[model samples]
Target: MSVAATLSPAADVRADFPGMVTGDGAPWHYLDTAATAQKPQAVIDAMTRALGVDYATVHRGVYGRSAQMTLGYEAARRRVAEFIGAKGEDEVIFVRGATEAINLVAASWGMAQIGEGDRIVLSMLEHHSNIVPWQMVAERTGAQIDVCPLTEDGRIDLGALEAMMTPRTRLVALAHVSNVLGSVLDARAAADIAHSVGAKLLLDGCQAAPRMALDMAALGCDFYALSGHKLYGPTGIGVLWAREEILGAMPPWQGGGAMIDRVTFEKTTYAPPPQRFEAGTPIITEAIALHAAIDYVAALGPDRLLAHEAGLARQLRDELRALNSVTLFGPEESAGIVSFAIEGVHPHDLGTILDEENVAIRAGHHCAQPLMDHLGVPATARASFGLYSDENDIAALLRGIERTQRIFG
Candidate 1:
């Protein structure tokens, strides 16, 4: 049962995204989607409208436009709630990005819950965002950090994770999908393992949320984080979703304007839950654009996006494997990300060559230097697919790789 045989492509979607073309209207073969996604015209239009005609600060002014902007901003939160299957908008706290989201959880929740001798578990495949925040928190709180090993095939080893869990384990933070390898985590299993020892699970959903249909309850994770840019929306807005009670209990990480119930020189009272965490001026235009992006993705079908990209991943892997000069990474069945190293070519060299062919690929450690070390490679050339990626992009990549191989020889 091959992934390609079982899955279909998110067909004919490239046209909706304006960035798919170059200055001369030639196709731009974008394969760096795991880093960030290209925005659809719908999202751009929504953002343009929001920043122009509907521009107003939220939750402050008694003016009519301010009230409407506030309504639109809150509506965006509800839309994310609907998209991710959170209990309500109260569970979603918008931040700068997934980086900030994780840092907030680490500072607010980790500071309070984790203490001396408490263990915080993370995996080898974590993005620096996930790894660094926990490290900062652990250092401050005197918490011990435990690194969970990955399976031979690159997936997070849940069996090993379960065995590692102890009563002292206060938190287990892992990626829902590997940003480098495209290895999808069995989040429910991880969540169960974390909870078995009375620890909370935080899933970095930056890679998963765009492709997979997310349900906070179904996943059983205590917290989930995702970025708007990766979800085909604007930057400067991301989400941190926690169980309603957990978010309510977690103290505000930052303090300022809108988050306060009332502020006095003598004493300051804070707002509740999401509002308390949001602090000052929120991501107004970005949130509204995110709402539009969610609508665009929903219209395409979230579950189907995974299937489509997985098929492409299988297709690319098969083609790259045939080259024999290419050393592929990750499992055979992965989401729409393929990483490999050429026998004699540096990833950066290959990337530059591909650029001349009007093809774009990510060539670096991808901010996962630990995973790069584990894989015994300095870095890899990664081709990550989005809803707009298609066979044409793959063909262009293969052509560029062949040219690189010839030049290297």
Candidate 2:
């Protein structure tokens, strides 16, 4: 593995974010990228311009500004589709976030396909968004939910996953990246296994989309879900990528205007792939902002951003491991997140102390309570990096931990 170090590297990335400048305040060291990344000026500017000067309803308006807004909105869908390497632009359905995307798939596709005696496979490492939706579908369809166990090192155990894949399996929903452990799953291999059993696969790509290069077609999954906020994009905008055939057959998840091609008091016919999933007035400004965010990330190049984050993670992990009281989890080569539990200190209290120091980190189950239970802790403090994260951020986190130890030790 090749790792390169460039001088004044993080400074350049930080310059693009207005939030990086904390006025008359201590340097804010943000290490909670996994929760939601700080937005760049490009994304903010795009959204401001759209809302400030060119705001209009998309896909329904006929005026000049409306046409421009509609074009920008559709263009964002294309960028999101291309970013994740979807087969067709229409495969990408915009939703509020990954949670809503999963709900849509489980409610629409799962409701239509899953039935009595069917099984939905999931990993114990899944976020609640991935796990709960399947459980809901299983309940509605009289289907069973099976959990794929994880290896001790935090990665998904393929052998166990294969064992759980019975002929009755209807769908397999899992995370492309474990939120808590920072363990990257071999989604392609998992997708292949699911397909071999004649089951469809859905990946919660919220964590993987920003940090990793995702090719949905190559991944062989039937559906892929990701959130824009986690990728430095606007909130209330997410991507749900499904094979056109599958999306076309699934029932509409929500019922409202814009999704139906024709409607009568007695009957209704739905629109195409994306519009079928999008039922109401969508988050137009946010979608446009997300496109700008995608453009910003593309400009920086995912390869370079990934390498920089990995470098930061490696350095943090090495240093944190040297702390006698800290117990770290996950693979040695992991995502740009380092999760740890300090003996005699609760994660919440640690987070509070860190916040006082202006060093933000996530402290909780991280919506991966199953993984937390697997690790035998109620919660862990997670410091996840992003494009603008630097060595100083990592150092601030360590200093915050030390301060926590002094207070609580």
Candidate 3:
């Protein structure tokens, strides 16, 4: 779909987010959700309870409270797996964030499967998290990397990606949505293209999981990654969902106390699948908070959130386009973000002025320096929306832009 065609009308849920208010009690127009979403009270309460009354290490605990905590932890894993439509909970591995999840795959699966002269296809709009890991793996594996171009509308050029795939292609990795451009990918089609060339596909769903409905089976991708913080949960927790067979086949990325079956001087046998990948002390409270975050979004409905944010993004783009000096990037119907630059003012200057007006936005390269270079600008000012955002926030942003222009003039 060109836009969020199935999105319903925006819901008024700002009160659910405690961070939506400024320190002085004014309504804080937070427009930088693409970096990290503000936590809901449900998530906060869940984490508080987990850390205070229910604290316990998982898996090895035998006491009643320990057992309860272990159950909660494992239940959280199941919830995460179900949320993303994983084949089973065993396929879900907890990592720090999507960045770590990508690295895990790169180090474990890529190192095991990718070899000399093997090709890996990547898009131009990939986040540094997605790009750097693959680059490191390719350097080690002696695999060659091919860069796919983007459409003029800022979407990844899948046609070019299909053309780029060859018999030697080992993997294809891309974002489910561009963090900077907010362009959504046709993940199912991308999966098909990769499979046609006997390659596995991995999607970074940091941006997509917040807005779209995800089904690992329907998407047909071998791997999917998401960050809890981006989904209105706590940081230090994210998920890597891979095919069960793939996880079983891949070697452990890290070694530590919990991820081992037996340890000895001669050898150590690793635990199965998910446990094998999660080494050392896991993020206990963060997982509980992530469960609450999933529940919060589920109650509101992902489809509704997608529509609501898309509406805000479309409106922002139209209004910004009306300004003669404003140059917009991304497709006409972005998921929940709008990136643009003023003709004369730098993005940092615009960001500063916007903050003075209580409208927070993201400025600079946004961790995608290659994309910035591709766009032929040092940086762009970005206003991203969340479930708490409303038309009032958009109006505040426009007013701030006008103020910035006057100040520059």
Candidate 4:
């Protein structure tokens, strides 16, 4: 069935968010949500309450309030794990963001497993966070990095990816959705491919976590990383979900506090699965805020949220396609993002004009310079959607574009 037909009706859930309303009485059109989403009042309230009502450190302090705060922090991990359909709470470990999550795996897991004569396969659609870590690993271990190509439609070239897979392939890393093109890669299929070549897969799920349904077992990837802020939560909190066995095998990425079982003058043993990964003090309040964000998204339901965003995407894409100066990128059926370029107009200039109208959009390489090179463009304008996005927001974007053309032409 077509994704459009499969979509369910979204409830008028935008009312829960106060940021949808503009302070100056002019409606603000938020379009750079792919970079960082606006937080709902529920998330804001949760963070504020955690800090205001009872603020204390988690996992270490022996005081009563600290114990209560630790419970809250651990509860947030369970919440995030269940939200992503992870098998158990132990699978989820908190990090700074998706960037840190990838780095953790690369530094700890990748460093231990990858060696000379090994190959790490990545895709053209990967963010710099996904790409650079592997490159660093390869430089240190003498492993070769192979890139899977993108089809003309901007999806991963499955044929090229299959060909790139070899016996020496150590790890396969790819984005679940392209930050630049909004292309959704088939994680399950990619996992199958990686397994066929004896390689484990890691999905950079920052772009997909907010918009797509995730089941770690179904995806069959070794690891999946997500950012809290992009998922409508607070910053400084993210998740790295790995298979239980994989987590057991991976060495701790960082050291200091909370991750140790025994600290002696000569030797120390690390803690178990999650706490072992979570070194030092965590963002306890932010983790609570993330739980609130997950509740916010869960209450709305993924199917309904997806449908609303899909409708908005179709409308925006169709309208933009009608413009003479515009050139669209990626597949016809994309996620809640529309990337485009205007003839003789720079993306920075376009973004500046949109800002004048209080319409925010991302204008750059989207941090995937390789993908930009593949698409034969230095940079492009990208408008990403969220639950608060509406049809009026798209219309506002069109109006801003019209104004830009009038001034530039």
Query: Best candidate per lDDT, number?
Result: 1
Q: Which regions of candidate 4 are displaced past 4 Å? A: 1-11
> Per-residue alpha-carbon lDDT of model 4 for 300-354, expressed as tens digits?
7876776667667787889998998999999877778889999989999999999
Looking at candidate 4, what is the lDDT of residue 129? 98
Candidate 2: C-alpha lDDT: 0.87
Per-residue lDDT tens digits for candidate 1, residues 1-409, read 5454345544567788999999999999999999999999999999999999989999888999999999999999999999999999899999999999999999999999999999999999999999999899888989999999998899999988999999999999999999999999999999999999999999999999999999889999999999999999999999999999998898888988888898889999999988999888889999999999999999889888998898899899989999967999988888888999999899999999999999999999999999999999999999999998887789999999999999998
> What is the TM-score (0 to 1) of candidate 3?
0.97
**Residue pairs in clash, model 2:** none
lDDT of 3: 0.92
Q: Rate the local accuracy (lDDT) of all candidates.
A: 0.93, 0.87, 0.92, 0.89
* Model 1, residue 150: C-alpha shift (Å): 1.0
Give me candidate 2's TM-score against the actual structure: 0.97
Model 2 lDDT per residue over 237-298, tens place: 89899999998888888899999999999999999888998999988999999999988888
Descending-TM-score candidate ranking: 1, 3, 2, 4
lDDT tens per residue, model 3, 20-130: 899989999999999999998889999999999999888777889888988899899999988999989999999999999999999999999999999988998899999
In terms of lDDT, model 1 sits at 0.93
In candidate 3, which residue ranges exceed 4 Å CA deviation?
Answer: 1-11
Go through the candidates in order and give the C-alpha RMSD of each one to the true structure.
Answer: 1.6, 1.7, 2.2, 2.2
